[model samples]
Target: MPLSEYEQRVLEQMERQLSSDDPKLVNTFQGRASSGLRRWVLVGLGAVVGLTVLVVGAATSNPIVGVLGFIVMFVSAVLAFSPPRRSGPTGVVGPDGTVRRPGTAPKPSRNQSFVQRMEARWERRRDERGR
Candidate 1:
């Protein structure tokens, strides 16, 4: 559905706030380069070829060709679903509670309950929505 002007303005304001608040997030999202129609067409063609090769190899009782066809299918599928590489600092939460993403303020390491964290996030979202 088309958003009304007020809704659009709110969304724009939110976007600006997000961009200013977390440049890493903005960079991650903006740096993504989606595969175009040509890429999809190529992936489709590859899948078709893979299927044909699989069928042919199976019919001819050739295991190598069948394996190759399976590999091709797997590769095409991976390519289709994989997002573009992120350009900003990526963080992984280690088992020892190590969070390391550069270019951002460090969050205090407090062992809050999952429900508490969820509620906090929910409240923040609700406040933003109300704005």
Candidate 2:
């Protein structure tokens, strides 16, 4: 099934409005971060250094030295494999302190209850069948 001209026009209008309202927000979604490769390379290097330290320390025979080496290796492996930590203003809490992911409109979401979504889906299905 394809969208009718009217539906396509409506979608285009909506997109235009959204772009106009928050261009920055739209750009963030469109843009891809390119620095992820650098992060991975750094992590790999750290892991190699950590492994070397662990092996040298283990060979020392002293318990403390061995433990330190193990700790370094563990830390390096963890840093290398763990998912990159994301930091940012994900959402600003109101004075009342409710956590909301950024770009989410609370009021619209609140108004769009489960029942409303079901009803909308039902309507769409009915319309498609009628078409």
Candidate 3:
């Protein structure tokens, strides 16, 4: 079902808040580089080549060639599973225990329960929308 206008506005507002709060998160998920697909394809090719090399080495009874093939396969598997490095100011936990992101003011520290924290966040959102 299509969202109503109010729901759309709220969704947009939340997105805006997220982007403003942590642009790195938005960038990481956006797939701007288009390298993820290419990386996976290359990894698959490398694995196939490595397997072929391994088979050839085993048939020829060459330990060195087999080792090289194993190394290649290992590296390819590592790269395929490794998480992409994010280059930006990482989040730091303040002395008061609130996470502070780059370029953002530290949130007021409240010794509140999880439910209270969520309620407070919801109240703040409501206040923001009221404006």
- Model 3 — which ten-residue stretch has the worst lDDT? 102-111
**CA lDDT, every model vs. true structure:** 0.78, 0.73, 0.82
CA lDDT, candidate 1, residue 57 = 89
Q: lDDT score, residue 78, model 1?
A: 86
What TM-score does each of the candidates earn? 0.41, 0.47, 0.49
The C-alpha RMSD in Å for every predicted model, in order, reads: 9.2, 8.5, 7.6
- lDDT winner between 1 and 2, please give it: 1
lDDT sort, best first: 3, 1, 2
lDDT of 1: 0.78
lDDT per residue for candidate 3 within 1-131, as digits (tens), equals 37799999999999999999999989887746767778899999999888888888999999889988888898899989999776655888755677878657566447878888778778766886795
Decreasing TM-score order of the candidates: 3, 2, 1
By TM-score, the better pick of 2 and 3 is 3
Clashing pairs in 2: none
Q: What is the lDDT of residue 44 in candidate 2?
A: 73
TM-score of 3: 0.49
lDDT by residue (tens digit), candidate 2, 83-127 = 876656778674456778886634434668899977866776798
- Candidate 1, superposed: residue stretches over 4 Å from native: 1-34, 87-104, 108-131
